[model samples]
Target: MTDTDNRRLLRQLFDAALAVAQPSQCLHHFLPPPVKGRTIVIGAGKASAAMAAALEAHWPDEDLSGLVVTRYGYAVPCKHIEIIEAAHPVPDEAGLVAAQRILSLVQGLTADDQVIMLISGGGSALLPLPADGVTLADKQAISHALLKSGATIKDINTVRRHLSAIKGGRLAAACYPAKVVNLLISDVPGDDPAAIASGPSLGDATTCKDALAIIDHFSIAVPPAAREGLASGRYESVKPDDKRLQNVTTHLVATPQRSLEAAANAARAHGVTPLILGDSIEGEAREVGKVMAGIARQVVTFQQPLPTPCVLLSGGETTVTVRGKGNGGRNVELLLAMAIDLAALPGVSALAADTDGVDGQSEIAGAIVTPDTLFRASRLGINALDYLSNNDGHGFFQALGDSVITGPTLTNVNDFRAILIR
Candidate 1:
């Protein structure tokens, strides 16, 4: 197959992966029965708006009224449930206000009433209600530092849950006496409910002490009030057996593994054997790229894993430690690192991208890696090593016109990667 054909196949596999995670496709089945009292819908995430729209479309007869906040440009039309656009990966005034509104909406509910929470990735940042004595600015600073520190999502959320007023089961706690059901789209490595969206509607197993240890380990600069809260253990999240979560039911509506399976099925349809590496793989992005490149080489050199015509697929989140000033995103970094390690090896091509349609601070989802990727870069006077060192994967792929732009997929199941060997 030509390079064009390989790129097209890579994109087709990615599209197949995305199809299963869409709120419209995966949410309706998890909907609960309507209660006698009012049903308040509340959520925060990149996919929450789309999830809310799906709920409204399916349950037209039910009296549904509530609010959901999604990242800007991800909102869909919904008549009853109000959709609010907010900032993501960073907390802003709009997000703070929306979170406050959501917290307020769940109040005053009785046993007959029910609260349905649509949770997914990016919700932790989109729903930023700092705990008492901790300001939003403090949370913002800590969040920025954590992103740059290359800390795992689980670690970042451990701090977020401890510092937030609404996360880590506090949202469910506020809706006491109400039957709370959470439909979560898992973007974390293990699909742990306590980690997805910081477990706003689920109980937390992590503690404030754990949050402090992570902060110290990463050497994150914490605001004074935040540091005190963490050190004093004064801002603990709701524990697993918290009484308020007794009536709450958390369901995994969509997950990275299911999406990977979808991509595997797509490969099968094309007569290419698919091997799912793992859905929970997590580590530094470039190192993961190097390791995956070795596997791809192994497939070609010995065919130990599978035959020539096979696709190695994996799903999970990867991290990047930013040491340069250039634009950096985890998916692109991984792809660039992979391309460099492969060094234009024959009969192998790959694509790495975040499923949410945003790779990092950029609008591009990710990029494609071909055998001639480095060759094309050199022809254009671009040095792959220099770009990688500068943490500018976005710029590197943008120059090649290879960055996959899928504006706001309105859903996220973490990163999707496929290495096709033929």
Candidate 2:
């Protein structure tokens, strides 16, 4: 296939991955039945606003009134459910206030009512209601430290669940006997309901001890008040057996695996054999890139995995330690490292991006890599190795005019990666 053909196919695969996670596709089947008293919708995440819009669109036109907070550019208009904009991947004053209101909205609910929580990636950070002793500043500091330390999502959320006033089943606890229904869009490695957005509605199996242990493991500098809260068990999560969370029912409306399947189908449509490596692949971004490059070489040189005209698809969250000062997200970072390892291997091109359309903190989604990626970089007076060392994947791709910019897709399913060999 020509480079244009290859890039088009890669783009199709990405669009397919995104389509499966959109609210219109995956959310309709999971909408809960209407309740007697009222159907209160409260949520926080990149997709919560769109989830609300989906729910309202399919409802029976009954009493459906609530609030949901999403990333600043992710909010879509909703008729009954109010959509509020907040910061994501990091909490801000807007998110804090939105969380406070979410808590207040769920209060004084009855057993006859129902509270539906639209949870997805970034929810934990969006709903930053700090615990009794911990301030939002403390939580924000810890969040920054964990993100830069290359801590896994599980560990980051473990700490977040304990420190927050409304995470790790605390949100469900607040709506006791009100039948909390969590409609989650999974972006985590394993589609663990309790791990999605720190499982604001689902019961938690982890404890404050686990949170403290993760802090120590990551060498995170926990604020004094937050540390005190953990030590005193004041910020402990609601246990799985807790009666307050008994009435909560969680459902994964969409997941990384589903998104990967969509991409695979797209690949097959283009007469390309699709190999889904896994949906839960996780590790450091650059390391994963190198490993993926090795697999692509195996396919290109030996055809052990499959013959040519094949695409390798995988989805999961990868972390960047952020040692460099340049702008780069995990997706682009992974691609840069992979390109360096491949060293202009013929007929091997790949695209890696976050399905939510925002990789890391930047508006750029991800980037594409070709067999001549390094060659093209050199032509542009760019050194791929130095870019990788400086964590400048976005810069490198932007300079090459190969960065994939999708803006806000109004949904979240973590990262999507595809390596095409032809």
> Per-candidate TM vs. native?
0.99, 0.98
> Which candidate comes out best when scored by TM-score?
1
Q: How do the residues 97-136 of candidate 1 rate in per-residue lDDT, one tens digit apiece?
A: 9999999998899999999999989999999999998888
Compose the digit string of candidate 2's lDDT tens values, residues 1-422: 69999999999999999898999888889888887788899998898988998898898876889999998999899888888887778788889999999999989989999998899888988899999888888878888888888888999999999999899888899998898888999999989999998988877899889999999988999778888889888888888999888788878999989989999998888899999999989999999999999999999889968898899999888889888897659999999999999999999999999988988878899999999889988988999989999888999999999999999998888999999999
- 380, model 1: CA deviation in Å? 0.8
Q: Give the CA lDDT, 0 to 100, for residue 327 in model 2.
A: 61
RMSD over all Cα atoms, model 2: 1.0
- Worst lDDT run of 10 residues, candidate 1, spans 55-64
Please give the CA lDDT of all the candidate structures.
Answer: 0.92, 0.90
Q: Flag regions of model 1 displaced more than 4 Å.
A: 60-62
